[model samples]
Target: MSDSVEQQLSLFRYLIQTRSFGDSTLRFLDSLLVSKDVKSLVEIRSSLNQLLKSESLSIIQSITAESVHNKLIVLDFFVCAFAIVGDLESCLALRYEALVVRELKSATIQLLHVSPLEWLNFVEDAVKNGFHAVAVKACENALRCIGNSDVQKLGRDVISDNLKANTISEITRLRNFSLASITSRSVQVQATEYLERKTREQQKLDLPYKEKRCLASTSFRNGIKRQNMRKLYKRQTLLRANSEMQGQHPNLS
Candidate 1:
């Protein structure tokens, strides 16, 4: 293999070993390899899946902060991989898993400090990729995180009120954007359905009229045929009467 390919493989191995999973990891991978490379994406996903599968059930069930954080990291990587592979369902599932893990009270805010920017990035990416539901879910989660958190609990000694306010503002804006997209999409679908239904109803309404017109045409043709038959019968009867009169008047001739 080429040196560049080897280097990418090395980096992938390091990422798997270190459990370093996030947007930066995805960016680095994209820089090294094509983002849409199915082979590379599948390889990374398989490795991550194996690692998760190898974990003990007991560890997963413990629900400690460390375990939750690690799980979130894996889930984040899974989401990124599934997204690149165009597996929207799996991507959304992993995102939801990450959100749920982050929401655990045992997952201390100090340890699992997901910034508003991170949430915004996820939401924006989801929206850009036509994952409005995922974007909306992310927005809701971000808002909930903000509402349930305080600057003091953020594990930052130098945090400010302004920072929290700004975070809230950003998340609210994202929420509104996602909601509007969903609403617009819903309205478009409803309008299309309405038009289709009306078209079908109009066709049904015109069917009887079409049948009536056909019946009227047939009746007119039948009436013309009956009138012609009567005229022919009258002409034949007059000719027969004339023949009888000629025979009876021969003696006078």
Candidate 2:
């Protein structure tokens, strides 16, 4: 392998093998982050965007931005995520650089500078096992509490359990939401179909019932003509009878 690859591999290996750092150890990493190669923290979204064609969601649950706050995994994951995606916002780089000058908030920002291979394994596990949140929180807690050699091992265990719990909880919530949405959508569809069917049924039922259809002016006019024809016949009959009586009375006159 080329010398640069070998060197990067060595650095990656060192980062993984090292335990979560305490105050002094973190301070050292803060210094190391000044270098350019490691600080592509903001490109995570773009790099991973295409990789997210399908989400099992069982593997990674939706989380509020607040749920991820002040955690070591949150910070480092942001770094990795931004690095992969592309740094649209300079915030990741600024944050990474700022910590180099200012001591990270009292909370230990866990820096697990693993090799590309190891980083892949860790991230893949999170995606596959639905434990990213757990992993993140575990690392955060590990960094915050890890002290001497004796504490580091113990801290890792504790952090791992905490991360697992968090991951399980988040996954459960998502599963519930998905199930609820399915139910809601199904209900809405059924209701709409039923309403449409009922509307059609009502229209069919109403078809048999007729409102009073008003007569057209032509029909009304015909009725008036028939009545006028009868009246004219009666008037002509009266005139004929009167004329016959007057003629019969002429000899008497």
Candidate 3:
């Protein structure tokens, strides 16, 4: 391959490793398709498929987490791949996937330059497909991007009219329930910690009393043993004195 092709391939390799796609990456891929034969495109697709099939892609997806920007970059790579094969349906599907992921709706509209009505219809389709939460999120995102008050009102109406009532209610209830549970757990933890501290304090306070009682009992037992020894010694002495008196008085008897 030529030096330029080598550089492009290097850039492609770097982008794939980072799980990122940008305009430069797209241009590089497109250049490969246009300058080289169809085999180059096939090789590119094979490489992408290999990457996508690996555990790394799943890890990248998971790491995207709540980051809309990272999510958008991943979506862009998928879109670039689908666009390379001229698979419009697949490209649109990636956008739908982006809808459910956080902040990606706004990313999609910004990057794809999707018109207000097109995105509105996309959101509608998502609702019709039973992705109520996705639809609601997309509508909410569109409101921020769409500067026109008319379009904003239209989006608000779509969310109010077309989205499922139970889905929204359930989401709200779950969010509130989660907050309440967290608060309850925090309070319980504090109460348990306080009780444990009081118990430790009580044990500390009672320690000296317990020691004093033990020492007093030990002294009383020692005193009783000493008194018993004295009584035993006096009885032995009296017995000896009686024996001596009997010996001296034998003559008188």
Candidate 4:
């Protein structure tokens, strides 16, 4: 077999060994990797969605830390695979599901704790893919996790106080960045809706043709100006935030 095929087989076996997936789910993933087509992707997504639902129910029935951790690992693998195949929508959906699972686990068992760096990575990935809402939710979850006294005690036991402080500081910075991104996106959406409303109003107005034209032109110009200003401000805000993050987290690329 070719090296590429060998590598694929190796990865498939590794996934099977590591993830606690059922036979059907494994088959779906195998099909996805082998075909790398839309149909296969859809099949895998459907199978994984069902698995997530079942796992969620299982968690409710009995909240075992091992089971929750296994589910999270499977989800991480699914998200990474979907991303590799360039299925942003599926990846995002799976990522959100993983977040939900984490939240549920945190709420129920309160034993399986997700680290700040893991949350940071998820937020970064969400932001990079323009999933601002997901990124913001992730930031919120991360902040909540950090605020938990149990999680703080666990972190203190595992790492030095200085390291934990740095991690918390970085998570805060990323949370602010994610909030800004969502806010900018929200503004853009509102601006688009406002422009659309203005256009509809202009169309329905009972003014003279010249007056209508002038009114529409002015409205369009003003809307464009406002949008441009918002865009410029967003750029500046993001740049400033990124600069600060880089300066603070020199190890992050």
Candidate 5:
């Protein structure tokens, strides 16, 4: 391998091996990020993924806002690899993970730095995942947050016309849809509804597989046949429904 490639690999190795997010560690990471060479990009992403996967979800959730922001940067970089490879699902999941982390209030005002191309991919993926309403809102927020100046800096050619014009056009198109009302809600309300609906939809889709798996376990089989189990399931379902409703009506307990 060439000296530059070898050096990048070494830096990638160090990033994966180091647990600290101190100044020196970040500087090394920034060097690899600045390189932006596609030759070792996949390897870099893999290293990031390995490091992320090593941390438990609870630990990640408990980290400081700064730590979470740093992790978000890593996720954004890793997402770029998938985005470049045209891996739509992977891109969407990474974006979703970032969104969930943001919703959890792990950090405030920390941007994930998604490119226009990735934004388009995320919108497409959200539509395919039956969250088209969420997709439109995300686009609106992106344009709004990036504002008039930086959007131009991101690249004027991506939209053919101009970023401002194209962004307004896109938002208008998204707003014309029926689901735009959902986006009009407060951010917290919007996130809660979107998550609840998505979760229920997913559960519905997984019902058959879940049933099949349940049948294989003696405990599950016995529980399903018990009268008390039926009552418990019904009560749990009611509680979940009530919680979703309560989220919409903030005045309720």
Candidate 6:
């Protein structure tokens, strides 16, 4: 595996562990993929869209506060992928916004299974466990807002508990595993790099340089004269690639 590949994977895991993808932050991720993967952000957008079909307090709690089956957010999602995965400050703000939206959208008579007693214990445990700012508030609100119904109450409690448990687990598992120690993740990162390199395509756009940039910035154009880009896309693609993800990770025997 290449060292460069290992670094990128390590960075990704570090972010997830940090709760960079908190409830509110997930919204921005949805937006980012939609924005960055311009030609097709719909895949990610769809995943988030499915979550907000109107959250039932009880339904959510089942996954958390009680013993029950849980759905995988991403199948084969590397257990390590939960590292600090985003800009923490920004995610905090997004979580606040999500709260406002929920208040507006949720049904008036909401209930959760977690009791007020449990909420107190959960909050204390979460704080000690070092949840991200947004995650802390989310669990707090989910606990407070959901009231009176065994199912809804249970669901909300579970959600909060789940958040706490997940944070603790990830932190413990990776506590000593630094970028230097994440071998499995690094190997996968290198594999992805090799796959992309092998699948590289050489194609002609049949258009002019300025026109291509204009299309990219403004709208996709149809017909155009064959001319070299004002600059090549390799430079453009490379510009966004992080230094960690850039270039070939030296092959290590």
lDDT tens digits by residue: candidate 3, 1-253: 4576667666766776765566776676666656446676676555544544453346446765556667666876776666674555455567756554533353445334444555566655554554455555556555543433222233334423224343334334433444455567779999999999999999999999999999999999999999999999999999898888888998743
Judging by lDDT against the true structure, name the best candidate. 1
Question: Clashing pairs in model 5?
Answer: none
Per-residue accuracy of model 2 over 1-102 as CA lDDT, tens digit each: 336444643453344234332344334333333335443422322223333212212112333233323234434533443343443233233233323222
User: TM-score rank, highest first?
Assistant: 1, 4, 3, 5, 2, 6
Query: Could you tell me how far off, in angstroms, the CA of residue 179 lies in candidate 4 after the best superposition?
Result: 1.9
Error of 6 at 195 (Å): 56
Give residue 241's error in model 1 in angstroms: 8.4
Residue-level lDDT of model 4, residues 120-226, one tens digit each, is 77777777888777776777777776666342554345645676577777767776787887788789999999999999888767467878789999999999999
Query: TM-scores across all candidates?
Result: 0.60, 0.28, 0.43, 0.50, 0.33, 0.20
Give the poorly placed runs of model 4, Cα more than 4 Å off. Answer: 1-81, 96-111, 150-157, 206-253
Candidate 1 off by > 4 Å? 1-70, 105-109, 152-159, 229-253
Candidate 5 similarity to native, TM-score: 0.33
lDDT of each: 0.68, 0.42, 0.59, 0.66, 0.58, 0.40
Model 5 lDDT tens row, 1-253:
3577567656655564454434565455545544466756766556544444443233345444566667676566545544544455556666766765554442244343444444555565676565666676666655554353243333344333465566556544654452554545557697899999999999998998888777778676686689787898999999999999999998987
State which candidate, 1 or 3, has the greater TM-score. Answer: 1
TM-score of 2: 0.28
TM-score (C-alpha, index-matched) for candidate 4: 0.50
lDDT of 1 by residue, 113-140 (tens): 6666567677776777777777778888
Task: Give the per-residue lDDT of model 6 (tens digit) for 1-253.
Answer: 2364345334534444443534544444333343454344454334323322222122333444432212223111211111223222333333344343435434542431224344444444434444434345545454444432233344434446555555444433333232223455679999999877666532233346666788786643332221234245666766666444544554421
Cand. 6 TM to true fold: 0.20
Cα displacement (Å) at residue 103, model 5: 14
Ranking by lDDT: 1, 4, 3, 5, 2, 6
